[model samples]
Target: MPRRARKYAVRTTYATNAALALVLAGALTACTGSSGSDGGEDGKAGDSSASPTAAEPGKYRTLPKPCDVVSVGTLREMLPGAAAEDDGTAAPSAGASPYEGEPTATYDTDRRVGCRWKNATSLSTRHLNIDFERVVSYDPAVSDDEQAERLYAKKARKAGIPLDPDDTSPDADSEPDPGSEPDSGSKSSGSPKTDSSKKDGEKGSGHKGGTSPDGHTSPSGAPDASSSPEDDVTDSPSATPGEDLAPRSLDDLGDAAYIDDELHTADSGLHRDITLVFRTANVIATVEYEQWVTDKHRIPDSQELQERARELAAQLAEQFED
Candidate 1:
């Protein structure tokens, strides 16, 4: 072969080899870069996987059957004079059974349940209502007890009952006595009439109906020595403080308990309402008992109704324990 031709071929071969080497190096760098970037991404994901994201579960998820929560014997004793249909008693017929209360309407039976009963007689009327609630925990950050506390606060507020149970009497400054305001006109009229009558008695005629100096018959006269003031006592209706009608806190009941008593006057008579609410764990139970009597001034025995309500509340709290 000619020398020049051989030299040119050798140069071309060298150039081709150098180009191939450069191409191979570039491909290797790209692979290394891709592998390194993938490794970095994988490392970031692995670090994040250590963090927890799941929430904690609640203790109670369901409530007891409202009607069955209270024993049958309790119902009979608590609701006196209740008719068969209203008391949950079944008829004597083949299918007839003792009274089992009717449940109230609710969006979800599992979360809440209630029952009511009522009966009326010619002399008096009676009614009973009960409710149950199941609490659930949805926050992973909060514990069941904490969630329950919050729920209890909400319920207490809605019921107008304080959490700590306000044992202290209402402040005089904050709440003015409703009966404190005086009637200026009544005072003025009463005093002048009394004074004038005394003056007239001292002056002349001792008769109670004697005319005053203005020639008007005296209506406010001193009573005769033979007559007693008992008639006045019998004729005037007295005003009472009605403290018995206030809601009071109870002790030795579940976590907390309260009783609210109200007196309602109607054409039938005076109705005494007693509402008892108790809490256990995450569940809250309420029982309302009411009765009407012919006596307008009669206040029902609170202890009796409280005992019955407490008995039922205890039974319901036991269900949570189970």
Candidate 2:
């Protein structure tokens, strides 16, 4: 071969070898990258294997299967005599006329009544007791109606009171007006009648002068004396305050119901129980968790578990109406 041609041939063979080596290197790198990505995806899916395929945003995230039992007990110790009197009357002991049995009540796993929980994510239960001795007595000389009106006026004044108009006309659809005059002139005429009869009926009858059984009343009759103002000022049955008996999961409770509340979780285990105590307000709730193990090498994530427990306790505390 010519000298120039031989040199060109040698250079071409070297260049071809270098290009082939580059292609092989790129192929090996692509395989490694693909393997790594697959491994990562598998690991993530495995970690979440216990999670439901689809769940509502705020619903139970992961509940224990087969259910675990949690016990709750509550007691209302009698307040001292002085404290009881301040509440209204002597604190009645349990088994007294109004209250029966021990002041304390208990509910075990078998006798659960108010306890409730989400099927998979949480188990919740609670109990409550009310110290009757601590109840305050309310006294008012006037009737309930008068008391109520006064209370209403007081509240209204505090909330920007408005003037009450003096319109005496019966509301539309009221009965015919009873003649107002007692025929005083006829009494001297010896018509065999006296004012006593009329007054007695007016005072003794349960019905108010202006108002009928259906709430229809003459606008002119003195505001029914039968409607005791005292009743109005006194606490209504619905207004009475006491601890509730419902056991609710943390997610289902609101913030106002509890005070000095806290939650904690264990550092390691396939199962964990969260204890929540509301000391000052006298409320307590417990939540238990069971982990489904997918791999022996994998351990429960402590940080994530604790965060979930806190969220549950906060939700339960918010349900109070104090």
User: Which candidate achieves the best lDDT against the true structure?
Assistant: 1
What TM-score do all the candidates reach, one by one? Answer: 0.56, 0.21
Q: Report every candidate's CA lDDT.
A: 0.52, 0.26
- Runs in model 1 with CA error above 4 Å? 1-53, 82-89, 92-98, 143-145, 165-251, 266-268
lDDT of model 2 at position 303: 36
Candidate 1 weakest lDDT stretch, 10 residues:
227-236
Candidate 1 per-residue lDDT, tens place, 1-322, comes to 9999999999999999999999999999999999999999999998788665654555676676776777767766665533343435555353323245667766567766777654443334455778765555455555454455555544444445555754333222232222222212111111112222222221110212222212233211221122211111111123222454346566666677776554444433444455677767666667776654444454445445556766776776676777
TM-score, model 1 to reference: 0.56
Candidate 2: tens digits of C-alpha lDDT, residues 148-184: 2333233222222232454232221122112111112
Name model 2 segments beyond 4 Å from true. Answer: 50-322
Write down the RMSD of all candidates, one decimal each.
18.2, 30.2
